[model samples]
Target: MSMTITEKILAAHVDADEVRPGEIIDCRVDFVFANDITAPLAIQEFQKMDIPQVFDPDRVAFVFDHYVPSKDIASAQQCKITRDFVRAHDLPHFYDIGRSGIAHVLLAEEGFVGPGDVFVGADSHTCNQGALGAFATGVGSSDLAAAMALGRLWLRVPETVKYVLRGKLQPWVTGKDLILAIIGRIGVDGARYGAMEFAGEALAHLSMDERFSITNMAVEAGAKNGIMEPDDVTLAWFRPRARRSSAMYRSDPDANYADVRDIDASALETVVSVPSSPGNVVPVREVAGVKVDQCFIGTCTNGRIEDLRMAATVLAGRKVHAETRLLVIPATPRIYRQALEEGLIQIFLDAGGAISTSTCGPCIGGHMGVLAEGEVCVSTSSRNFIGRMGHRQSQVYLSNAGVAAASAVLGRLAHPDEVVRAPVPV
Candidate 1:
């Protein structure tokens, strides 16, 4: 039976000869994780099972990110609960305050997940790992608890929606723009309960970091998961940091797909998702000149070193608009350190942007850079739902780091070309 990459991985995990879409199967999970914001609930549920220990300490991870460096008493207490649980279980993958970063990005950086694995996390953006060809998805706390205890999960296989990318990308246009354009074309529920499989010759042009950005927002389009086949680019990035053996999987040429969409990458422009909905996307020029009070560049979606390099290139010799506040955060300690070594951090500071420790702080409105009511912000984070970053009335426009940096300088939503006539070397 021909199978898609998603089906191949799912079938392999379950020791099955074949699995069809909508089929319920019990599959072993290669990795399971939860962050500070979601781990406490999962821990409580796990305790109810009276399980003395996790299925495998090495395969479970706990990341303290959302409000780490605890913003308030409530958040501090939440971390305490998960920390205590991790210590009790002697979990080897516990990431605390100083070592913590966004769970999705941190897991990939540490090589906790890789090709042909089934990864489940309590965070929606867990789909980010799919860039490595993993069948990764987000689950509820109860489901997380079950997976942690049993090392297995029940999944209803999803039909696949294959997106074929052809042609080269334009300058300053990235995977973020591609995804926003996708969401805009096919509303938020377009791929609901289906696997979004990305393929085509254009994959060769997208870096691993950009691929991660694309998969990270799969949930925003209501997909069950988003995945790319394990190609040379994915292998080059995963092989060095891989902590365990990984199997590479690809879709059979004759595999069935629920739908197929072809995208012309060269035609894509730097795009942004307007306030309140990721599906509300348009070219950067469409919303240019709209006033912005803040600009944020960080999160699992676009916080990689590549993203910082792009932002730095634009902000290198310029100053941030005096009326606007720009906040720059690296997604992980390692990324933060690399930015410092590369002088990316200095360029941001010199441009009047504030740098933060690795955390999801401002992205979640937990602390740092929360917006005032009716204010406008241009962010590189994943979602921009109502009250996602602060006051319900505050508006957030989602864009790639370059666009966000350019917007910071113009004090409004602007195209990267509006600020940099010639790109500066980072």
Candidate 2:
């Protein structure tokens, strides 16, 4: 009996010859993380354990990102708690405002994550790191606290859903659009408690950033985790940054899949997830001309150098519509610096978009650019649950950076090409 990558990795870490889905097993973790939103509670739980010290302080990371610059008094206290824990433990991986961005992006850019490693974070999008071919997932405060204290956690192996995607994507179509399409096709809970393994020849055309975008949204479909098989592209990205090398894992030739599906990548179009749920997706053209009060082009799901460049290309010589506020946040501080060096920041500023520090800002309604009552926003952030970004009455439309940027220019939902092909000057 052959095993999928998720099974193989779990089995190896648990020192088992083989493992099957539904089997509960304890496995050591390569990395554990928590953010300002969840770390305070996890810290309280960790203190309750009465451990002299954490299992390995180096293996644990604390990032203050959810409400950077501190949204309010309560948020400030939460960040302070994380800082106190870091100082007490002398944890080198722990980071404060400037040194950290979003925990998921910071970990990857700063070399704390890589292929075949098991990573757990107190963030649902922690699975965002799985783009590098790792078995990463998000857990609750209690599970994260325990993992921090004991350096291990119990997991019920998830059966695999193999997506054998094949075809070249349309020019304006992106990983964000592709994932939204998947969510639309499957509904939100389509892959509940399952591991999503993306395979097939189409993987060859995807960049590491693109692959990360796809897996980062696996949680939207209720998957336990998402993974990609490592090849030369992964090794190239990891070779220069990995602190420790681990054996690369892949599914066996005859690995059994719980279900198999195929997506015609070439047929995908830029799409948006309407307010209230990520699964409520439709093509960009369907929603074109829908008025918007704001547009945001960054989040763990679509915030990176590549995403920044795409948005800049759209807004290079244009200005944001007077009625719409555009906010562009890079996912990590390093990406922030790179954007500045490339003059992307200037392009954003000149185009009337506000350039902010790398923080989850506004994505979680923490601060920076929250929507108001009855407001409509075209955002590139993940999750559009009612009240997810602001007041329950405010609406959020989720789409790629291209669509988000274009919407800001027109003050209405539209595709990137629509703006470019228009007759009037932006």
Candidate 3:
């Protein structure tokens, strides 16, 4: 039987010669992750157990991302518990508020994950690491506790759904649009519990950041995870880390693909995930003229330096609409420091955008940019479920940071081309 990249990784984890899609195989997890929101409970559960030592302290990652700086008293206590656990176990990797970004981005930036590995995290977006070709997935708190106790977790090998993308995207189109359009075709649960493998010519044109934008939202499609082959761009990112961490690997050429879905990237225009759900998608032009109260750029979805640069291209020398409150958050403290050095922060501030600390912020609605009742906001965050950004009546439009920046300036749904286009190489 031919095995896809995901199946190959799962097989490697289980020490199997070959594993087929849809076949249930209990495999060991290579690493485990828990963020501030879930780490407290997981640690409490771990305390109930009498494990001598964690399977591998180095294999465990604890990040203070969701409630970084602790929004409230309860959140502060939760993070304190996580800090205590990390110190007690002597885990090698601990990302505090100033150092941590979104768990997914920070994971890759720090070289904690690699291809052909089976990794699990206690948060839903844990699948984001799959962009690097690792078979990463999300699990519950109990599972995290068990992984900490034994340094191993189990998984059912998932069936894979391949997306064969073709053609270069037109101006204003981005990986966010590609994934949102796919969600439209497959509906919210179309790929539920299945791995999404992106391939073909269109994928080659996508940058690592863009591929991340696709993989980060795979959970919304009900996927086990989403992955792309490691190309030169990925290698460039990995090679440096390999000098310190273990080496990384690409998917073997003979890797098998289970099902292939083709997409025309050029045909993809700007897409918007309307309020209350990621599946509520439509072309941006269709929703033009609708006014919004706020616009936010930055999240695990599209908060990298490149994403900020794209927004800066739109916001430079332009004022945000008076009625719209625009907020820009860098994904991590490192990214924030880079933006400062690159003058990106000045551009955003000059455009009347509020800069947020490197935390999840309004992406999960803890604070920073919560919307009021009946307010409409354009954002670069992952989900838009009910009350995701604030009051239940508040509406959210999900797009790339480029679109969010453009909409902030225009006070309505606007395309990236209307504000900023991909920079032409000099």
Candidate 4:
């Protein structure tokens, strides 16, 4: 049987001679990542180890991003510990809050990940980088401790689930809609411990931002990873900014797929994942009449420059609906500065969208834009788990930036194509 890119990569990483779908292989991780929120605890555990230094300093990346600028005392303490520990260890890839966006974004953008690599992170969304053909997944504090102590970890090779998307995505329908629709069909945990492989002509047309949106939510499907074969689009995205060497991955044509899903892109519409679960999805029109109190258009999941550009296109010359409170948050200082230089920030401001600092913010209920009881918000951020953003009573609808911006203007569910023709340049 032929293997998918994900399976091929895992095969090379497996300790055994080869790994097949449904088979478990004991393999060691190639890299481990820790950030401000989780690194503190992992570091505390590492101190208990007898080893004087990390097994491979170059293989570890320490990043401070979740609560960059320290929203509260607890977060401030976490950031301090992260900074001190990384500096003391003389790690090669330590990123401060400003330089740090989300760890996965930074890791992929920095060319730290490659095909057949086994990567782990303390954050659940660490699965985001699996798009690059690595066996990337999240782990708990105890698992992170072991990885740090030995620079190694065990893994069970996962089966690959193939999603072959054909046709073109409608103007308003983006990667967020595709992922949500898939989750709705398969249920939240349908892909548990499995690998998702996206292919077909539709993927060839997608940009890096779009790929990230899909891969970021793989964890919601309970998948070990989500991956796509690297093509010209992937190469173009990394070629210019690649600091060091870059690597790519391609799937074997004859590879076996544990499961296969076929999506006709032309058939897709702007879909939304309702509150409390990512798989609670429905078409926008099904819930269009409902009014919303807030709209958010940023997060690691969809807060890149491309997302802001899409929002700006939808909001140009339009005002946010008086009943809705719209907020835009850049994911990093680089993105914030780029938005300013491109005047995308002005468009948002003119549209009555409040701008917040680059942080996880309302996405994780960390800070900013907390929803009140019974309030409803449409957001571009990932996840809609119960109490994810604030009070359990609050409702959150997840969509792409286009839908988020359009909803802000209508104060109800709105599709981006109905409001704008195309994405604005940044």
Candidate 5:
């Protein structure tokens, strides 16, 4: 039986010959994780199971990325519960405030995820690891507890939707723009309960960081998961960091797909998702001149070093608009250190942008750059739903880091070229 990469990984985990879409199968999980916002509840559930300890201490991780440094008493208590549980279990994978980054980015950086693996987390962006050709997805807190206790999860196989990318990307256009374009064309529920499989020669042009950005937002499209086949680029990024052996899987040529879409990458331009919905996307030029009170560049979606570099390139030799405030966040401690070494941190400070310790703060309306009522923000984070970043009436426009930086300088939604005379490389 021919199978797509998603099917292949799922089948291998279950010791099955092959698995079909919509079929329920019990499979072993390679890794399981939960963040501060979700882990506390998951821990409560895990305790109810009366399980002495996790299935495997090495395979379970707890990350304190959201509200790290504790936004308030309630959040502080939540972390305390999870901290107590971790200490009791003697889990070596716990990442506290100083060492924590976004769970999705930190897990990959710490070498917990790899190709042909099946992993789950309590957060929606868990699908982010599917970029490495892994079968990854988000689950509820209860489901996370079950996985942590049993080290196995039952999954209803998702049908695959293949996307072929042809041609080259335009300058300043990135994986973020491509995903926004996809979500705009297919609405939010377009791929509900399905797998989005990305392939085609254009994958060669995207860096591992960009690929992570694309997969990170697959949940926004309502997909069960998003994946890319392992190639030289994927191997190059994972081989050095891999702590365990990894198997690379590919879709059989004759594999069945629920749908196929071919994207012309060269035609794509820098685009942004307008207020309230990621599906509401438009070219940056269309929304140009709209006033912005804040501009944020960080999150699992676009907080990599590559993203920081892009923002810094646009902000160099210029000052942020006095009417607008800029916040720059690196996704992980390592990335933060790299940015400092590269002098990107200085460029942002010189441009009047505030830098933050690695945290998912403003991205979740937790702390740090929360929006005021009726204010406007241009962010590089995933999702912009109502009240997602702060006041329900506040608006968020989602864009790549370069666009966010350019918007910060103009005090409105603007193209990066407006700030830089030449096209900044992707």
Candidate 6:
């Protein structure tokens, strides 16, 4: 009868005290969301259903992130559609370029999500919100449409994969490195359709930003969700920001798990995923001399304030290679301002790096840093499928902020320790 965190949370939403994996359940939705890229389609479908009104305006959110500045007429039209929909529905949670952050980051910082809530977003990375102990996942536009009109949705409960993390991470090793090692060991799709529940002493040492990076990429492994149960760390991050307080939930001590992975956090090394697949990973040493044309540190994956600080530590006074382009993007406007106030922006500029507006720009290869034919890059963003960032022949090596900073300096793949420390300009 014991249940995991995902099971316990879903059970409450459906009036059950406990539910087993694979059970079909009709559940109440705590929130429904879609970004500029997905919301237009969801709204069109919602209109076809003859739903004149949204279930709850306050419970619905729309963010103008992806291509928000309107890369072209098409993107501009998408933004206009989302803008009108938010206005027509009186959606209070709506956010535009100047007003909001990336959808996942903004929602979390604005107090819209909390422990034990079921949040459905129209983007795959919605699972990122699960770091707060919520059962968050990406659903298709049609699924989002129905959730918007009826305030409910159906889901087949998924089994859980428990990860017990131990030990402290070595300096320069990060959650990105830890998760990359896991994907490398298990391969992509390792946790297919299963909930990835991370726990253990190591979780205590990771900040919410670091945990967000790990959970945000759960989809790359085909996981249904990636959740970390609430603790003192979670409480501290959520208490000041949560719009609503929901009772926290935890897995039963004897909870049944589909499988359990034990990881020694200290044993991890800087890792990178080779071009085309996140699972094709290796230590930085293996690819130490591989040349890269660009380096990117942004997107929902590693574009937080903490991530920027890591890169700053590595770049402080040094300039990036003249032949390599380094693009640094903060995930949200708040993070952008904080970086500026802290002079991280100035540091990057003095080091010959380019700072961009807070948007899902080059990470999606939409703009800001598109790769040319046969080019290669080291990036902190997730997903490097064939031509994921531009030209099919162009390659991308996935790494963390530390690797990204060092790689930019050498115009090739390198580790943080390999770079000579530089002094900040006076």
lDDT comparing candidate 2 with the true structure: 0.89
Each model's TM-score, in the order given? Answer: 0.98, 0.98, 0.95, 0.93, 0.98, 0.98
Candidate 4 per-residue lDDT, tens place, 1-426, comes to: 456776666666654445776676655677888888899998888888766778888888887777776888988988888788778888888888667776777787777775557788998888777666566888877678788778777667788888999998987788878888888889989899988888888877788888888888898899888887777777777666554453455777777778788989779988999878999999987888679899998886889889999899889988898999999988767778999999999999988899977777788877788888898989998888777888889889999898899899888988876667544334
Off by more than 4 A, model 5 = 422-426
- Per-residue lDDT of model 5, residues 1-426, tens digit only: 999999999999989899999999898999999999999999999999999999999999999999988989999999999999999889999999999999999999888999999989999999999999898999999999999999999899999999898887899999999989999998899999999999887778999999999899999999999999999999989999998899999999999999999999889989999989999999999999999999999999999999999999899878899999999999999999999999999999999999999899998888999999999999999899999999999999999999999999989899999989855334
lDDT: which is higher, 1 or 2?
A: 1
Model 2: per-residue Cα lDDT over 1-426, one tens digit each:
699999988988898999999999998899899999899999999999998788998889998888988878988988899899888888988878888887888898877888889999999998887778899999999999999999999999999999888898787898888889988998899989999898877777888888888889999999989999988988888778898776688899899899889999888888999988999999989989999999998889988888889888888889999999999999888999999999999999999999888788888887999889999999888899998888889999999888999899989998999777775463
lDDT (CA) per prediction: 0.93, 0.89, 0.84, 0.81, 0.94, 0.89
Model 2 scores worst on lDDT over the 10 consecutive residues at: 417-426
Clash statistics: count for each candidate:
0, 0, 1, 4, 0, 0
lDDT of 1 by residue, 126-147 (tens): 9999999999999999999999
RMSD value for candidate 5: 2.0
Q: Extract clashing residue pairs from model 6.
A: none
Better of 4 and 5 by lDDT: 5
Cα deviation of 268 in candidate 4 (Å)? 0.6
Instruction: Give the Å error, residue 304, model 6.
Output: 0.5
Model 3, stretches more than 4 Å misplaced? 243-258, 420-426
- Between which residue pairs do clashes occur in model 2? none
The residue-by-residue lDDT of candidate 3 on 1-426, one tens digit each, is 556778777777778888876677767887888999888888878878877567888788898888767879988999889888788878888998777888888888878887666778999888888877788889888889898787666666777778989999876688888999999889889889898888889978888888888998999999988887777777777767642333244455666655678888888888999877899899998888789899999888899999998899888888898899899989988889999999999999989999988878889888888889999999999889989999999989999888899899889889867665544223
Q: In angstroms, give how far residue 50 of model 2 lies from its true place.
A: 1.1
